[model samples]
Target: MALGLFWATVCLCVFVAVLSLDIMGFFSRGNKFQVEGRTVILTGGSYGMGKEVAKLLSQRGANLIIVARNVDKLKAAIEYAKSHAKNPSTQRFHYISADVCSEAENERLLKEATEWNNGKIPEIVWANAGSSTPMMWLESSIETQKQQMDMNYWATAYLAHKTLKAWLYPQTPYSPREKSAKAEAPRHFIMTSSAICFYSFTGYNPYGPAKWAMRGLCDGLRQEVLLYNGARRSTKKTGQEPAPFDINIQMVFPGNMKTPGHELENLTKPPITFILEKDDPEQTELAAATAAIKGLEAGNYYTSTNWLCDVMRISALGGNPRDNIIKDTVGQWLTSIVWLFVGPDLDGKVWNWGKKEGMPELKPEKRIAR
Candidate 1:
């Protein structure tokens, strides 16, 4: 009798959970990331997931400006985006060659993009330009660490800062009449972070922290935007013309994408790092970008491109908002329970690797002077 009662309760819980999820799905039906006829600035669009995202956005009728340092690749990416445009005659595509790692260049890119868009700031800005040079903490040079931070964290920060300032504090403030004349869709600022931000392993000392910093920035901005959004809605009482539209701050956490950047990363990846992440699933650039866009449309703040990344994300959610509170709460509990075992298991692997392989030897050129 007790065994039957236990089974019955389990089935009842499962049914309730499924029913709740279905009901939530019903309420969240419409696409939140509507981009038709909007202007978008996409950094690092010359290759990898950025290029794939540009193509997808073009298909959705967004006017695109792709930015990268390589002029040849930028030209190719623009042509590719133009070819996939939904309205070939109406949609426009352009490319800019600039190193986004430089703060001045990021500002210039946004200014140029605004100018190109007839003095209106882009509705969407995606900071997807980043690089990784994975190595053990001591094995990596200080210059390499700084470079990783510059590319992964500072570049995104600089762009987000300039874009938000332009969006919220426009030089020519919106008139009350202007604000009421048109109901604008929410503006979106997206940053690309790595799954390593959630849980890092050996050989990612230089890269992982930079990605983690991006998560911190995203979390803080997500909360900060709420203040501006609230103030925008209370314009009558404040007697101030609010921002043109509500701002949406989001981040994408992608894992193991098969791109040219991934190939370059592998060339510097340590052998132990390979063993640790050998089981991780790799996605084609298109698959990763598709998942990211789907998450955006679903109104997810922290979008994970795969199941593993989702698990990692929930495990380290910290102060980030949960897209589905009930689902994320349950997942978080399960992940916490699982990590009790996973954490030790990963540590054991690292220890065993050291015992089996001895200390890793640095190349002669990599050695610091005594």
Candidate 2:
């Protein structure tokens, strides 16, 4: 038993040392990518996190193509972008007002953006529009659920579909010369999936599942974006250079923020949710945007602010991951079991909430308190 314990200790130490090195990037991918002078199409850019992201990128000399359903707000966003840009003389800003949930609208936005930018595909395409209607799953209508899917999932998917054609797909004989001309210029596709993507609370309901679906899609898309090994070998065998596969996929899972929508969500949020969120009321939009930019520049495959989000993210990595490995599959299972046990109790509390004196309906008839 003494010898077995000794070996176990040694193995654990070795594992920690390796993981630590990987986390420190001693054995990680190069993070030399730059956002400077890049053209970007940012959805939901009128206000909140989207507006903040635009400001940060503009300050770094990136051109902005801001989109949202609010023309007045989008125009203001463009003015902000222009004034703050590192090189205002060289910077360009455009605004479009369209509902991002419409695939046709998104397609038109993409077309107009590319055309306005002198036929240059944006270096970064950011899907930042998202919404949540707070209610229990049973209380939320199917329309409410579908609205979440449209904004959080389909919008991102449509953007990725259009952008990746220019960013990822390798050139063929039939490929357009203009597309093949520039070896993919390290394009970035950024999507905003909430920290709730990792786990859902009682009041979050459909919104949580919608975000989870978005995260799952991002994971699968990350894998699918890989340039085929066969293509790489074939190029080398034929003494031809392989096309550059510089498309970077980044998904940010931000914690609660002091956005307008957040205020709207709070009216119906569960008492238990506040207990779980126990952190300071709101992480400023600026702070969240800063963390996101830093993470993207550092090549983090998964970027987040809250401790809970990080814990859940690190715990979800598989046999192969680009970074973050605090524990293995077995440890993750154990951790999940703990949450699983806690989950039912949370539900029970919620169930009892309904039975309490003057309890508000999960879908309160009047959302905001007068």
Candidate 3:
């Protein structure tokens, strides 16, 4: 009877151990970053994908500071975002009319975010402002190209720089309670790049290179964050306290969306460009915003509304995060091969129809009735 009791006790201990591990696994699966109550400073937040993101974050109870160049548009966007807020009485919606591309403006934006709400700094920063003019590299001016780069690449870099500096520069030793609080609140930076950063079509000269630079910037930022993680782990392994750094990075490569920027870009696009998007299902600004939010909730490093677009990024896989390791490796090579064939066909379209029609700078072309 004593022997029987000993065996039963062993079985009970095993069962308890298994149950504990399962519970730990559930919480450690992945970081689910929710936007609720987090201060989110979104650039280009007045229109297009930015506007939609504001609405979604507002509904989720995020305190917002929308940055844009236009005051009138900012006011309208503020009203729109507030109306969608889960609790308008409590949610803070403020607008900063500043050109985020400028260095001074970017710095000021960060200062405001830190000082807002009685010294509560922003936990989430969304670099979602960019515009591209549809012109071949040879046809585009150097100044216009530089301006585009300022908006697309420089703005993203500025925001990342500010947030990373803010985190790393203020590394402080915390008490047990402070350490627990730090572990609970992680910082997130999401930058909006373009799928063209991976694969470019014809007439995407200046824009393609500018967006490609954004991807490069994101890669560098994420790698630096990983380095911080490595140092923290190394310190902890040495039985010393790790430096306080808990940050996550996400790069968004969005496809076409129905926004003012999209419409304006389409006005100057080649006929082949129109042909390419004709078959794809309609995607709106809200849809793109929804995908971004969902990606954040899922803790994905790369996010996009279109599956093909996401696959294209992984397929390129230069410095991008792998999808699922083995699955992503296979998918990358397979998709790369398929694109090898599709790419040349697209090149043919460029060679065949390379006319620049419907440019607003030039007079409208007269169309004859059939």
Candidate 4:
């Protein structure tokens, strides 16, 4: 019995070491964006991955507008950027305390950003605010589920729509003609979605549905933006009346993250208690989770080191992915029977940190006729 226990402890240690190595590999290959003099807004920037992204953009001299529900946290984040930013002149930062889940708050936040910039619209907007309910299939509370849906689905959709509409309308001092002349500069709307969108999980009751909805919303909007912009460009070529806007939308499907909220102690409470036990081998897996979460949270899959390359490829290509492509191709399943009998595949589709190389390049392709 003593020998068996010793071997078990050794095996667990080895497994953890391997997991840490895999996660570290992803971080080494992370794609860092160099943006300067560009206006970028990030929701949930008060802490965790959002704050890190703000710090990154600040370092690159990008004007930042950080949003979160906490006013104090937002202020602190703004202060941090002010202190850490390299070229403060090139990076003007602002903060707006609002809930991304509320439509009124979304409109108010965008309006505030524009107003703060003297009516100049932001060139890059990242819809990165999200809340999760990691409850078992049956244990999720009504309030938790509703909040997740609001933050994860409706809030994302509302903010995306508002941001796109604002981007489409020509701003003051820059008329439609001036904007059209600079066609090469694509306006970006980066949606922070999730990889669970590609597959279902027994542990994800409400959160999965909301995230899946975000994927659908992104796909639909992606097609619309392409169609809208394509028609405008075609009209310009024919010397006819041109359509209004040229917008490029990018959707991101983040995996597990290591935000403060994702702490194992917090997750082991209330809603998440059923899904995660303190004694589980993967119970306190923060580094792996951070790799997955930070990847999508960074506004691109490559940012997460390479865990979500497949989803990013589909988003950039502007093509509808067949349902269950990730699940079928990668074999990710989280059904009750599977979870109970097979246990979580810590290294499979749920946590693929090395697949970033397979992501499709972001080269622009000629638009196909509708």
- Strongest candidate by lDDT: 1
lDDT of each: 0.87, 0.75, 0.76, 0.62
- Which regions of candidate 1 are displaced past 4 Å? 1-25, 172-181, 235-240, 364-370
Q: How many Å off is the CA of 294 in candidate 4?
A: 11
RMSD of each: 3.8, 4.3, 9.6, 14.9
Candidate 4 — which residues are off by over 4 angstroms? 1-34, 171-180, 236-245, 264-370
lDDT per residue for candidate 4 within 220-310, as digits (tens), equals 7867887668776563465344434456566655455546666542443332233333232231223433443444334342222233434
Lowest-sum lDDT 10-residue window in model 3: 172-181
Q: What is candidate 1's lDDT per residue for 69-149, written digit by digit as tens?
A: 989899999999899999999998888888889998988888888878877788999999998787678878788789889
- Candidate number with greatest TM-score: 1
Best of the two (3, 4) by lDDT? 3
Residues 1-370 of candidate 2 have per-residue lDDT tens digits of 9999999999999988887786676875555446677889999888998899999999988889998987889888888878888987888889988888888787788778877878766778999988777766676677778887898889888888777764444342122225244445566788999888776777677788888888888888777666542354353554444445456677998888888878888876656667656653467899888888877877778887665666666556554364444544545777677767766876776667667745665553334431
Q: Whole-model lDDT, candidate 3?
A: 0.76
**lDDT value for candidate 4?**
0.62
Sorted by lDDT (best first), the order is: 1, 3, 2, 4
Which residue pairs show backbone clashes in model 4?
A: 256-293, 257-293, 258-290, 295-304
Clash count, candidate 2: 0
